[model samples]
Target chain A: MEKGLIAIAAALAVMTGMVTGIGEASVARQAVESIGKNPDAADKIRSMAILGAAISETCAIYGMLVAFLIIFVLGA
Target chain B: MRAVFELQGTVFYIIAVCLAILVFLIILNMKLKKFDPLDEPKGLVLMAMMGVNFIENMLKKDTNKEMTEKLGPYLAFLFIYIFIANISGLFGLTPPTSNYSVTLTLAAITCIMIEYYSIKYNGVKSYVKKLFEPLAPFVVINIISKVGTLLSLSLRLFGNIIAGSILMSVVYQLLARVSALIPVIGKFNFVGVIVCSVLHMYFDLFAGAMQTYLFGTLTVAFISNELPEEAKGK
Candidate 1:
């Protein structure tokens, strides 16, 4: 059971990283495209991108917490 | 396990450091030719917003004047700083505002500042009298309402950020398992990323900014209400 849980935790970490990376890429793309079309809106787009990326990372944090709980609390 | 700083002490330090950096940056930027020359840079613009908020209360204005003018910038700054702090969870840094002590101290400072200015602008007698007006024997209720501001502000900020962080972690873990079972679609984890990013932006950044603005505006309203009719120039 412990082995299984550890495997699960590892998987979760990877997923979190993947999700965060994808989210960041999309936001970056959108930001760049928007800036290219309207240089004047670059500041707004940058702020939005930052906000979008920060929000996107929430899932990763959730995954980490669960992995910790499983390891420490469940002793898995 | 050893306490480096008592929780409250740590909170005080965080607030002090944040405020000190804000003040120092403001003063330094003011002297820099580039900052003052044409249009202000984005970083300095954010800082200036904060500076305006800090000085908002100090500016004397009639009661009829819209309170936003005095409090808007400060509210904007509070939101920006608090939102940034809360979102620091993404980078694995413990959000200072996540701790109750930090929020409580911030609320307390705002409360004290509002009350102090109220009394200063209006003599003690009038200040006390204003509390009893439009209704009598409800002075205690009014005082409690004032104190309640701290509780509401602290809890709102703390609850939102904590919930967002906790939820994000949980979702990531669950999704990871699902993705593993379906290997073909696993290569594109774009959906998870987009969902998480949007949620963080809304809950942490957007909401956080709005909350900060509300808190600052509320403080201005609370203090302005205490000013005497003459002081209001009405």
Candidate 2:
């Protein structure tokens, strides 16, 4: 029963990636549109987009960390 | 002592740092013949110049000319060290960045740089006041945000590299098992060879380069973000 619970918890932790993926998808879309409109500013736009995407991805990373802990530390 | 020394990733960390230093030393000691400005550069000179140009451009983008001049060498060293460490996985060594210790130390250094710049540019009075700004109770949240930058920076690099390495191993294991089901061809593990290389190209090469660039760029961004607007460079 405990093992089953651990598995479910791990799965739930990784589910945070669903939200993060959607967030970053929009970030990338807008970044591409901005670059298309201003070709000369592409470099600046690309860096800003990447930075924003990375910040948004942190919640998913934290979720993965928790999942790894649950599986490896608790389940073990 | 044995446990500390036996940490699996330490050796790789040392190897990566040494390799970066070795590259730096070799380039430092190089005696290049003077060439015409318009002539095509060759060999190590060309590579070294290209790397300098790239690092300088990156530094100039985030900070003022004086800040770049001061921080350029350290940031260049950082870029080289991180790139070497991240890509070391390609050569069969576990990338040191998969270890939280390595990433945390790098993040801590970045935090220190940010604080140092903030104090220097904004002054101690303003820095402390800004923390308590608009309300006194917000200090807790302000402190958390300061610490969050360190945690988030370290975890971003660590999680990405560790996840990639773990996934690669799992893929290899599954591929090996699948190949073992074949009769004679299973001995060569051809399935793994064909598929694992492509996966390595993405996980090791592409991810490593991207994370290295991101880490370096973010370090610059965080430091400059802390500086006053007047102090910020074009």
Candidate 3:
């Protein structure tokens, strides 16, 4: 019963990724739109987009990290 | 080994591995000392030139000449050490960066440098003013964000390596299950060898290099950001 509860909790904790997915899509869309407008600045825009995306994904990573910690470390 | 030397295994392994790589790099660099880089270098000479050029170009682009000269060697050492540590997982040893002790030390040094240099370049008054910003309430957020940088930098590297190692173990377990359908080969992990090779390529080599690039680039970018705009040649 405790194992099941922990498992369910871990699953629910990762629901934060839903927001992350939407955020990632919007970031990509804007990056692509900007690149299209300024062809010459594509390299700079690409690097900026990657750095921005990586930052935006932090919350999702944190969520997964917490879930894993809860399931393995706390549940134990 | 432990009985003879009374040594802790992981600590000893980390030291020996790092020293071995350092020695190898030194020997390679020594061998290339006589080669002129402009004469269409090849082989080991070309590799050394590529590494030096990468660091020089990266530092030149990011910082002023004085700052570049001051910090270039430090950043280059950081880049090479981390690149090796990340890929060291391929040797079936614990990558030092995956250890929180190692990562925390690196991040703490970076954080201290960021704070120190920012204050030094901008002066205490301006640094405090920058923190307070257009509103007083933002100071709390500013402080939190500073801590955030340290946590994110360290955690990102640690979490990535640990997660990859965990997933690779899972892959091994799955491989064992699949191979169990066959004969005694299951005990020997026949399927694991094939699948793990591809997994290791993705996880260790490709991801390792990419993460090293991200870490190095972010270090330069963050340091540059901390400098005054005029100082940064903006």
Candidate 4:
């Protein structure tokens, strides 16, 4: 029962990726829209978008770390 | 039972670092004859010059001539070392950047550089005063945020690389199992060979380059923000 609960907790923890995916999707969408408006600035906009998306990815990573800890440390 | 002293990827990381240093040493040790403006640089000279020029141009955006002169080589080295380390997985080696300790130390160095430049440019008095900001109580929060940058920087690189590795391994395992269903060819992972190359292109090459560029850019941004606009030559 405890192991099952731990599995559930890990699953919950990994749900943070969903949040990150949504955030990154919006970031890419805006970047593409801006590039369409001003193609000359696409390079700068693309870099900025990638940076922002990468930074936002830290949240999901933290969640993943927690999930791994729960499964490996606790489940063990 | 899991070993308490996990030494995962340390050896591979060291190998990657040595490889990066050796490459740089070779490039640095090369003898070059002075050439006319019309003469084109060839081979290693072209690569070395282009790398230096690229790093300098990137630094020029955020720093003054003196700052760029000081930081250009260091940032170039950091970028190359990270790019090499992150992509070492392609050569059947564990990528050192995926290791938390390795990424943490790298981020700590960047954090130290940020603080060093902040103190150097803005003076010790202003540095301490900036921590207090609008109120004395804010110092705790300020310190936390400063430390947060260190953790975030390290964790970002570590997480990205590790995630890519984890996903690739899972994919490979799945591919092997799927390929095993075949009758005769089940002996070999034919599916993995075909699919993994595409996956490696994104997971290793693209991600490695992007992370290296982001790390360099963020390091420059953080450090340069501490300097005055005049000092930054912008």
Candidate 5:
């Protein structure tokens, strides 16, 4: 039962990426639209878009870290 | 033909490699300074300049204008150090970043810098004052945010690089086993090499560069965020 709980928790942890994926996709979509409208500023827009995406990526990273800690660090 | 000393631990190997890289970089800098005015810096010097400029531009985006020049080299070195640690896997060595302890140590340093600047430049009175401003109970939330930053930054680098290395190994084992079906090339690791090279390119090179950029960028952002703009003016 303890192992089952750990597995379920790990799955939920990985699911955090779903939200991040949607968030990043929306950011990319808007960045593409902005770049299309103003091609001259594409460089700046691209950098900003990447940084924004990375910030969102942090959530998924945290989730993975939690799963790792539960399975490995906690001796579960 | 003889060994003078035996290095037994991973930590020692990491120190040796990092020191070698630093020494090589110091020599490169010495060479860079003697360049003729008529010619552009080529090879290592040009790459070094580009790296510095990249970090400089990221920093210049901050509202605190003074930090761009002051913190530029420190953050750029952070990028280079982490980049090498991440890519060590490509050379058949364990990437230093694959270990949690190294990443945690780097994060600890970042946390120290963040707190030091937070209390030092912000002034202890204002630091305490601002925590209670808007509400007295917000101090706990503010402290949690600080711990959250340290955890997230270290773990992101650790998780991404280790996942890459693990997947690359799996790819290698699978390819080697599958290659045995070919009688002529059964004894060779060639298929494993060719297949795993493609995987390693993405896992190590691309991921390594991105992790380095993220780690350095986050460090700069954290430090500058803690520093008060008005206090930084002098």
Candidate 6:
């Protein structure tokens, strides 16, 4: 049961990373496109995109932490 | 746990000493008016700006060319100092930020300052209205976002500092073992030293500074946006 739980946790971590990566990539791409259309506002758009990416990346980090806890603490 | 500090003493001392040096430098700059360009001749304005730039670059100046320049440096200084203090734990010293009270207090102060300034600059009515920006439903979302900022900022700093410290410890242990195998390689400790130094600078210094700048800049951006147009014009 314990091993099964660890497997589930690890799989969830991978999925979290994938979902966050996709979300951030799309947001970043749209931000760049906006900047390309309006060069004068590039700095504002870029900063917003970076902020979004940073926030999104937190999910992946949390996922990794959960995976580590399951593997090391739960002995899975 | 008690012996942890014994191993991390060097890191602690370095951080403390660096902070002391920064404080001293600030005092010296103030006393000497080291980079003050208030009285420079017209042609020397550029030179004066360059002088200011040089000092700022060395001292890790967090000030930008905007009105918030007055507040940026102090915020940056606090973030960098706290970050180093937290990461010093990896060297075996206890992370000050690991104490929830410390991080919570910092976050509270930042949130309070943001709200206080916004209200001060925009008046209560405008400030309250800002909570409902874009749509009425956004009022709750905006309030939650403010709370989320406090939580996220504190957790992000705490998480990164702790992780960096742990990674440093693991890398040190692995390298120590690798050096044990090659007796001659032990003499040239530069490899390990260089790698460790680069990692520490990137993880602790660069990221620390970036986080500090982000915090301060975000505060300024949020408050300024909340300000009345006339006040912002000034």
lDDT of each: 0.64, 0.86, 0.80, 0.86, 0.81, 0.64
Label model 1 with its docking quality class.
incorrect
Cα lDDT of model 2 by residue, A1-76, tens digit: 9999999999999999999999999999999999999999999998899989989988898898889899999999
Sort order, TM-score high to low: 2, 3, 4, 5, 6, 1
Index of the highest-DockQ prediction? 2
Judging by DockQ, tell me the better candidate of 3 and 6. Answer: 3
Candidate number with the higher lDDT (1 or 2): 2
Interface RMSD of each: 9.3, 1.0, 1.7, 2.0, 1.8, 3.0
Docking quality (DockQ) for each candidate: 0.03, 0.72, 0.45, 0.48, 0.60, 0.27
Query: Candidate 4: misplaced stretches above 4 Å?
Result: A38-51, B1-9, B20-38
TM-score of each: 0.55, 0.91, 0.88, 0.87, 0.85, 0.62
lDDT of residue B157 for candidate 3: 76
TM-score winner among the candidates?
2
- The better candidate by DockQ, 3 or 4, is 4
Whole-structure CA lDDT of model 6: 0.64
B1-234, model 1: which lDDT tens digit per residue?
998865554465466547755776677666554554466556656666566645453333424344446555555556556656665555555567777677777778777867887888777987888899769988988888786666655665665566676787787667666666766877565556756787767766776666555455455556666666666633
lDDT per residue (tens digit) for residues B1-234 in model 3: 457665445576579568977897888878688776567788887787788788877777767888777777777777777778888878888777777677777878888888988998999999999999879999999999999888777777777777777798899899988998897656788899898999999887887787777777777778888988788642
**What lDDT is reached at residue B41 by model 2?**
81
Model 1 reaches what TM-score against the true structure? 0.55
Instruction: Give the clashing pairs for model 4.
Output: none
* Stretches of candidate 3 exceeding 4 Å from the true structure: B1-10
Residue by residue across B1-234, what tens digits does model 2's lDDT show? 356546465765667667767976676555344545687887767877898898888877777888888788878877777777877777777888888888999999889889988999899999999999779999999999999899899998888899899998998889889999999879777898899899888888899889888888888888878888787666
**Candidate 5 interface RMS:** 1.8
Error of 6 at B50 (Å): 7.1
Can you write out model 4's per-residue Cα lDDT over B31-123, one digit (the tens) per residue?
A: 344434477878767777898988888788778888898888789878888998888889877888988888999999999999999999899
Compute fnat per model.
0.00, 0.53, 0.07, 0.33, 0.67, 0.00
